[model samples]
Target: MIVVDGHCDVLWRLWEDPERSFSDGTLQAGAERLAAGNVRAQVFALFVPPQVPRGQRLKAALAMVDRWHGEVVENAGFRPLLWRDDVPRVTGGDRPWALLALEGAEALEGELVHLRVLYHLGLRMVGLTWNEANEAADGCGEARGGGLTRFGRSLVEEINRLSLLLDVAHLSERGFWEAAEHYDGPLVASHANCRAVHDHPRNLTDDQLRAIAESGGVVGLTFVPAFLTGGEATRDDVRRHLEHAESVAGEDHVAFGSDFDGIDRVVAGLEHAACYAEWADYLLRYYPASSVEKWLAGNWLRVLAARLPARPMTNL
Candidate 1:
């Protein structure tokens, strides 16, 4: 089966340490590990940490995008999916595909044009906020629990106009609802779990999961141990989140986000990208092959095909 992981911080890691090789095994999403896991496509997130000054966030994001082009694009066995049509080419070939995603809108610096600039740079997915309030919206970490601002709603409209995937992974409850209400395009919680299974701010509530399902989007069940439970997390812990998410979101809306390098602590047996097949075997025991196939990659592919623009956008 072709596996498509929804989120990883490998680009941020590479930007942090320029000498780190993509083939390095210590990283959760090393190129070798991805190959071993049979991952057909992996979403690389451009995550600007909150500490970066607002003025410099855009530059930081561009630098990571440069690193992606400089390093990953040069790799022989990898291809970057710049448009929806690029998906089939990569999936049908022997090489692995890389999809660009913005983990937070801080990089946009409250300007809608910056979103267009990033889109030109090959960004296909965007998340409005990371863990705190930005100019666009309040995040899960915000104490006030506010929703999308006027600018945030406008950004959602622009994202729809551009035909990019809108990710609601770290939005506050109100912000999520705001986007859900306005944006009729493809939506995804790139790296979130079920709050019903584990009560964490990052985990989506059952209602949130159902909203994603009803929209024909997928909830990528992540591997964050803390989001899985208060105690140490194991493969079974991952199973619990998946089971609960499937119950609420239905099998078609559930998939693997992994959160690989983005997460600090790892699940016991499913530590890195290379171990995905092992987890797949475990999931197979409980779910039928067809359901497991959807969880592995089909669901994400379906969303991408539906949401991505048919023709690439030109200079405006």
Candidate 2:
């Protein structure tokens, strides 16, 4: 079975001070684990933390993107994929598909010019905020769930114009509603669980889930234990959120967004990317192969196909 994970913090680890690598050593979901699990593609998010200075955040993110790009360039087997045409080509051979993404719009630094710069750098997706308020949008973890700011609205316009995807995962309630109303394309909660099951701010509310579904978007059921069925979550706990998402958002909008290397509490059996097939096996008893395929990979590809243009990657 081919798996397409919607989000992972693998890039942060790959370029951090310690300098993580995927060349057959040192981590769980490296090239080795991915190949062993029959994984087709994995979206590695450059999730910028709030601890960094405002001016330096984008630089840090770009540094990570540059490092990954270098790895892809030096190794022909792995390539950076940004469009639908690249997807089929990257997944066709022994190569593992890599989709570059930004986990927060803070990297934009309240400037639209930065958006174009990041786009040119091969960023295909952007999450409006993390857990703190930024110039773009308010975050769920902020004290107040204020809506998108004026700059945030402008940011969305440029994002739509550039044909880049907008992720509302960490945005506040008001920000989410605003994004839904403003953006013309499908939305995504790259790594979030169902709030109906768990009351964490990181989880999505019922109305939020409905809005995404109505907009023809996908909700990647995150694997963080805290957001699962509460304390000490297991594989079954993660399944609970998936089942609820299928019922509310329908099977069409549910997908996997394991927040690997970013979260502390991961379900027991579903600890890493390689365990994707194991989770699929357990889900098969509850869902058909066709349904599982849509949840695991097809739904995500559909969202990308709908949002991104057929622009070619020119800059190396």
Candidate 3:
């Protein structure tokens, strides 16, 4: 299967530790492991934590992007999945394709010019906040639970105007709705589960799921234990979350985002990218081949086809 993970934290992990190998088994979404899993197209998130000093946050994010370009791309031989047409290059190929993503807009520092710089550097996806308030919007974990700020509303317009992917994975409920209202184009919750299933604040409500579907977007079911079950989470928890997401968002709007390397705890039997093939097998018993195909890769492919710009901004 030509699997595509909407989010992973390999870039941030690599930036944090310069000595690690991009293809080694140490990281959950290591290049070699993803190849084993047939995850041909992977989105590596350049995550800058809110804990990073305000001025240095963008520097940290840029450093991760540098790791992505200088290390992973060079050592792993992964092609950049720049345009929708670029998808076919990784189909059954020996090497996987890499798509750069920003997990939090703090790196942008409330400036659209930096967004253009990242876009020029091959950043295709952007998430507004991590777990706290930023100039863009409030995160789910923020106690105040505020919506998108005035700057955030403008950011949405700029993201849409530039034809970049907007991810609402960690946004507050009000921010999500506001972003949806501002962005009529496809927007994904790149690494989120169903809140109705586990009741985690990070997970999306059924209403949010439907809203994503309504906007022609996908919801990536992450493999975090806390978001899966109160007790020990296993492959079955993944199945249950997928079932709930499919029930709420329909098969067309559900896909996988491992959140690998970014997460401290992973579901049992789903330790790394290589384990996704096994997860796909388990899902087959519950869903049809076609639906399973969508969940594993097709849904994400559909979103990219619709959202990615037809031509590259070579002049910029």
lDDT of each: 0.89, 0.82, 0.87
Those runs of model 1 whose alpha carbons end farther than 4 Å from true positions after fitting are: 313-316
Give the range where candidate 1 is weakest over 10 consecutive residues by summed lDDT.
307-316
Q: Write the per-residue lDDT of candidate 2 for residues 109-192, one digit (tens) a residue.
A: 888888788787788888888888999888998998898999999989988888888899989999999988899999888989
Query: 45 in model 1: Cα distance from truth in Å?
Result: 0.3
Better of 2 and 3 by lDDT: 3
Per-model TM-score, in order, reads 0.96, 0.94, 0.96
TM-score of 1: 0.96
Per-residue alpha-carbon lDDT of candidate 3 for residues 1-316, written as tens digits (9 for 90 to 100):
6689989998888888889878767989997788788888999998887678878977898888888887678878888877867765656657778999988789999898899999988999889889888999999989999999998999889888878899999999998999899985787999999889889999999899999998899998898888899668999888888888888888899998989998887788999999888877887877789988888888888888888866656733
Error of 1 at 196 (Å): 0.8
lDDT, candidate 3, at 8? 94
Clash count in backbone of candidate 3 = 0
Local lDDT at 80 for model 1: 74
Q: Lowest summed-lDDT stretch of 10 residues in model 2?
A: 71-80
lDDT leader: 1
